[model samples]
Target: MLLDALVNTTDAVASTRSRLAKVEALAGLLAQLEPDEIAPAVGFLLGKPRQGRVGVGWRGLSAAMGAPAAESSLTIADLDALLDRLAEASGAGSAGDRSRELGEFTALATEREQDFITRALLGDMRTGALEGVLTDAVARAADRPGDVVRRAAMLSGDLGETARLALTGTAEELDAVGLVVGRPVLPMLAATAASTSAALETTGEASVEYKLDGARIQVHRAGDEIRVFTRSLADITHRVPEVVEVVRNLPVRDVILDGETLSLDEDGAPRPFQETMSRFGADAARETVLHPWFFDILHVDGRDLLDEPLSTRLAELERVAGAHRIPGEVTADPEVAERVSRDAIEAGQEGVVVKAIGSPYAAGRRGSSWIKVKPVHTFDLVVLASEWGYGRRKGWLSNLHLGALDPTGEFGEPGGYVMVGKTFKGLTDELLRWQTEYFPQIEVRSSAGTVWVAPTTVVEIAIDGVQRSSRYPGGIALRFARVKRYRDDKPASEADTIQTLRALLRE
Candidate 1:
């Protein structure tokens, strides 16, 4: 298929706020794609290239812009091949080679195609076709069940591969995409509640587990081999050998454990989040030893527990994890839940997560089955832009412009971020220096004092609450907002949404 066809479909998807319309447009395009082209096309539509980062940034992209072709002649295969070559470019002269290759590729694409490619490369595709919408479209195009396609996508942790399988492979093959011991599946996510009582109300007879302020790790063990993955499904096995050893000592021969790992001080108190992340990101061994705490077990001894209830999984986890199991209590009493929350906080944990005892693990989906409660109102928002600091903090990026996701375009462009507020508080000098050095690399444009970025950085912001305001496009402003930390472990697509913040007004 021609690249123009996919670009036109994305444009159509972005032009409408109706999700059905976007799905229909995407489905129509998906049906026309050849079996081999489905995966790359899906990746491009999702604003992520299958080749991953190709070392091409905004500056490199700008240098590559040239006169566009009058007509559309580039095929999807041609674009994928170009990206493959660009991804393979490395070594000393890789930058110049990438620029030259990008220039040649852009010269052959039409204006619309160029814009689409640019947005895709920058992870800024604003089409309303999010993964859920696109999954529906894929199912519609392939004449398969939506649940089947969704399960396949979630278990495989690859929507592109799921699309290829659903479109070209048999239904049995698609359904057969089960949990593998080493490959990481998408981690289950949680919704939020105001308090432990509120969370328990949503999940009756719940397991109120401590919500640790640490890095999420998914450990997979088969025989003696172990691997660790982050919340975003990035492999960090080599960086965390201690975690591997802990999982390696598990009683089961094969198991999949979901949990958190963090560095602790001599007093057994959790270290600062940045300290844990620094240790987690480093490949070399450090003095800080990270302790693994398992909360849920997905698979053990060839028994897949994902379809099992939380009660069952907890039983399995208790049997195998022993001292490594996260602290929690299974109770229906609201008072008991509140006590657990207090205990967790006093223990230097975040708060508590109330999970329904009978609820199955819903990977990649955030539902009310598991609800987290914390004292402070915190949200993972995207960094839309940043302004230059002044006075004593001069020459650094200090003020951060925050945005919330609008997946349905209720407040703005579909699958785009809507600016809600800005904050300069809570940033240390180190953070300011990091921001100054980082933002420009992903910058799309700049004004007199602000540099607009690609809205790809996810930062955790603590707020008193949100109030109705006309100052921002989202009709709400954050009250007393401050940065808690930068969530490098999370993605912008998974950040909290505008609708979520608007719901706070009711609270």
Candidate 2:
């Protein structure tokens, strides 16, 4: 239950990819922990605190967190005492008394704990060590994949399910029920084609659809009540009130639809994702702002559409979703698919995710099943996990490693997978806090502060082209990889594969 114990394990899990093996390792370690340590243990690895970490941003807030336990205290326990005092202050204290009290507390806490608490409150621990990694460690201990554990964790809203499962054996019961996105159905794998002819040649029957640039959304509805979630299952119902209202007004009462929530300019061109996210913070977002475009329905009335193909869902989605239409459908013709991709790009959108008619909405699965072919304009890549960001980059995430799926092994891997390069750009003061908190979590095995992470984050890697490499994991290195915008829409597993990067070179 010591904070260090949990922190250490989190470091271990972030580096370990084998979820099943992690579970075994954690099971042994968890058995030694006390019951009281359970929630804190879970919370830490989960990338949060048991008592939601007390954060301090303002100098006043910083002062309170840094306040010493007493004249002689220096431990985190002392900081906790200082924070506890914040919750106990009386309003009767005049402004002068309040200022004095604040000053006293700030001076008492150690500089280290004070800074840590300050960033914690801000909630952007850019530390490569993140809760997702801890979730993976917990999942590994549970004999499932970290993602499987994360899906289950998100559903339960609890991470301690790991220890409980180890002792009681109920964790397996939950994992048995996969967190499906839409209708419960096995996901169909996708076929890759370097060109339109190549794509059509593989599928005996071919169909293509306009790949909108927006966050992939899956909705589950019953009557007027509906839950709008992201492909990752994060409840976005609150973030996209406009879409929720649209869902409530839909013609069908009971239905589940799949779609994208795009941010568009007056011309209907997709806006930058950051702009779309910023709008969510507006008071008007609740009144009216942002747009919802539904494209596929996985369930309608009382029937499930998993057995049905993408073609059937598109038709049904249009009918039930109303205004939500399949943007544009393309015939299986390779030349036509290419034309559509070009048009989407010229229209100022990111690129396209060419979905076949027979595909299923694969929940928690990333394959060619649903693919993203981005615009020639490379999206930005943020430095996620770095080794020292070092040398001149020391103390920063120096080397930028980028990832995206390679439906083809053009980059030479089984799938296109590669780590771009190190970057010294796109970092901010706030980002420094993030790296400080997060990088430690993802640190595979580190000495002092120097560390490494399993290349698991997707950075919009750009380049003149890729070249053979002996230093990087994907066998190729980016020419001049630097920080771009941080992406939350595209998950790490969904990052460009080495093969996909190869075509960029070929082009």
Clash count list over all predictions: 0, 58
Best-matching candidate per TM-score? 1
**Winning model by lDDT:** 1
Q: For residues 81-158, what per-residue lDDT tens digits would candidate 2 score against the true structure?
A: 444454455566543454565567556544543444443333323233334444554555556555556555544435
lDDT of each: 0.92, 0.53
TM-score, cand. 2:
0.61
| Global CA lDDT computed for model 2 | 0.53
Determine the backbone clash count of candidate 1.
Answer: 0
Error of 1 at 306 (Å): 0.7
Give the lDDT of residue 174 in candidate 1: 91
